[model samples]
Target: MADAPRSTPGREITTGERRRKAWANWSGAVRGIADSLLSPATTDELREIVLDDAARARGIGVVGSGHSYADLVAPAGRTLLDLRHHRGIDTVDPAAMTVTVRAGTTMRELNQELAAAGYALPNQSAIDEQTVAGVVATATHGSSPGLGTLSSHVVAARVLTADGRVRTVTRDDPELDGVRVHLGCLGVVLDLTFTVVPGHRLRKVVHRKPLPEVLADLGAFRDVHFGGFWWYPHTSQAIVWEASPTDEPPTPPPARPGALLSLLCNNSWTPRIAGAAHYAAAVAAGRGGARVLRRDDALLHHLPPPVQGTEYSVPFDRAADAIRALVGEVRRGGLRVSAPVDVRFTAADTGWLSPSRQSPTCHIGVTHPVSAHDPQGWIAPLRAADSVLWEFDGRPHWAKVHFRTGRELASRYPEWDRFQELRRTWDPDGVFLGAHLRRLFEH
Candidate 1:
């Protein structure tokens, strides 16, 4: 018999990591909630507060909008560094196609401000709930043909090191690659400067079709525009496409007040009921698809709240096969996947640990609705099949759910050592080390 995979050192090295088992993340997956939550408005202030706190307990975590459900921000018995008060956009350079913003600013706020200036992010992830700093820190992305993840837009960033100092670095600098997606372990992301495209009008075209035809011609279709697909479980059909215009007017989709109300009901009364209703609607419609026109702000990022999900990025070449197999695994395992399987594309970028690392990739994200009726035991079977993702050289989204440990994380990220080394150099006292950071890197 094969031996069980050795637990990574980071998992058990620190007292905080041990206590993390009890913290609760955004998903309602409770773990060890922090004893104290600190909101710091300035980099200098944060640096001082972190160092002083480290004297007693070195455990610490930096959080943005708390969009990630994974333990990414769950630090046990440690000081939680909330950057919301640090929100600010410092500069915008139209000629350079760049803008500098505070770590605490949400994508929603940032886009709105940028639009007022006729500038916008070139690539953005699906949701506006994420913080600019957090998104870049975790390499969050959206579906777009030949586009890179949000971090790739970064040209420079200011970091608050453990020793109560601030360091501003740029893409041309040698340390840039390591910091692009530093995961808050290396240093607190104080501010980031990113390249932006001129704000423009965008038109969306969403429709449904057979999965086979969509997959077969995906590349050609991808070439014509920026978009992707969402496949429903228990069916071979898919919501085939949504494309954005390069030079269209800013026309946003119709706000779904009804859906919002339903979501509120789910969260308030029966979470499962809300998800079930949404799922049934999609399934009954065979596919509910729509196209809307919106300003680049609305088109680039605006997904209604999602419970939580696991997102995997596989090389474009293996995407279709991997997705089909994943679909089968869901059926074989009998997992109730209420959320549509999201598929998005991106061209490779130079960011060392970015999911799009030097290769075109497709992001396939799967989700199960939150339920009070199901136990952790019910998820056991599906969790067992997560390795299917690794089999295809898939990298799990840093912000989503996954069972992989630090060793697995190290192997997946080529710049893992660089990030660790930076953390060591900047935070020798482990001022920024916490349960989440330890799990993903310390080991």
Candidate 2:
């Protein structure tokens, strides 16, 4: 489910003329006015705020790097805590192969720092605009059947729970699983310690083929270190992206002149002209050869226009059937999608509420740029696809957009009740379970 999207055009927009208290999410999809905004520089300062009775009643929520499309970060009437400035690497243990970072640090910052230290995460997320906490909270994954979600790599964490305590959670602790991907309902995560891999290079090879053919034999590339595909809607073309660990020396893409202008040509200029040029360029291109990059940059994608995105996971064995059914359903519904359909896969994980829990999974992501003419046009097609994917026991990616409530989702997860029970134990007073979280976890 790791499709990289750059931050929104203008970041989070502030509304409210009087004091500009209202905030819009990265995609401008969710907007609300927080009762107050708080910035805590250090864990002590944050803890002091948590100790104050005021924080509990306000139902505080942390705003990460503004990457999530869901309402998870909308603190409407509640308090919004900004941690953008509260970030930096704390420690790097080369012997233990672990790195400790402040919870507010962005994936970009983390990766740069790790590379400098000769360490790296074994897998790369499509998007690293999110904070470590936000990324782990939603179980953001990478493209590898052998590697699970990024959260699965966290070995330990320090959390400020509802009881006004700074607790250390480790692999030995039962609460660690819940902490791995609880949608920030457990409590405010102060920091995390993750196992790191040695700095390594990955060689990515590109191939183009018909969509139906790729779908029919998706498992052929299953053992590749990292693999995925993008299917252009209404077109028979699909691109297979495969990257594997390479000891060969890195051969990064050549530094070209006017890089910025070239980017603008693809992301901005192409879309404005009906993507005819872009489509022509892509279809006319060959294998596009191969390039090597650090793990952090391996699967990162070029930016697209502001878009609404969502994904669902089906069992690896059932993925082909599920995707075929989804395509047929969308065609029957007469829904039009201009952007390509992104399909990725990940190894099964242990997180209690993880979509891929208990089974290796295939993730299919759909996206469409915001249309001023028809703002909510994507919803109908996604809902229609959901009806079809649900037949294969699809589990929606928590960080993406979806329309399922907890009632409809209870039976899909094995530890659903245990996760809820832990939420109550961690935040019994409901300081963290605001309306958005309540609907997903309670209702």
* Model 1 misplaced stretches (Cα beyond 4 Å): 1-24, 53-56, 246-252, 257-280, 283-292, 295-306, 375-378, 381-385
User: What TM-score, over all chains together, does every model reach?
Assistant: 0.85, 0.89
User: Candidate 2: where are CA atoms >4 Å away?
Assistant: 1-20, 254-281, 284-287
On TM-score, the candidate that comes out on top is 2
lDDT per residue as tens, model 1, 1-443: 01323211111112454442334555565456564466655555576665664322536677676667677676566666777677868999878889999889988899889988888788667768778988987788866766788888889998877766788898669788878877777778888999988776665666667778877776674584577777755556676555665564444465554664335322322325534554554444433344445444434433534355777888888888888778677667545555567788888876777877887888888765455555353244335436677778888887777878889867877877876777789888776666666656656
How many pairs of residues collide in each model?
A: 14, 1
Q: Quick one: best lDDT, which candidate?
A: 2
Cα TM-score of candidate 1: 0.85
Candidate 2, residues 287-339, lDDT tens digits: the string is 45688988778778765556777788888999999878766755564444556
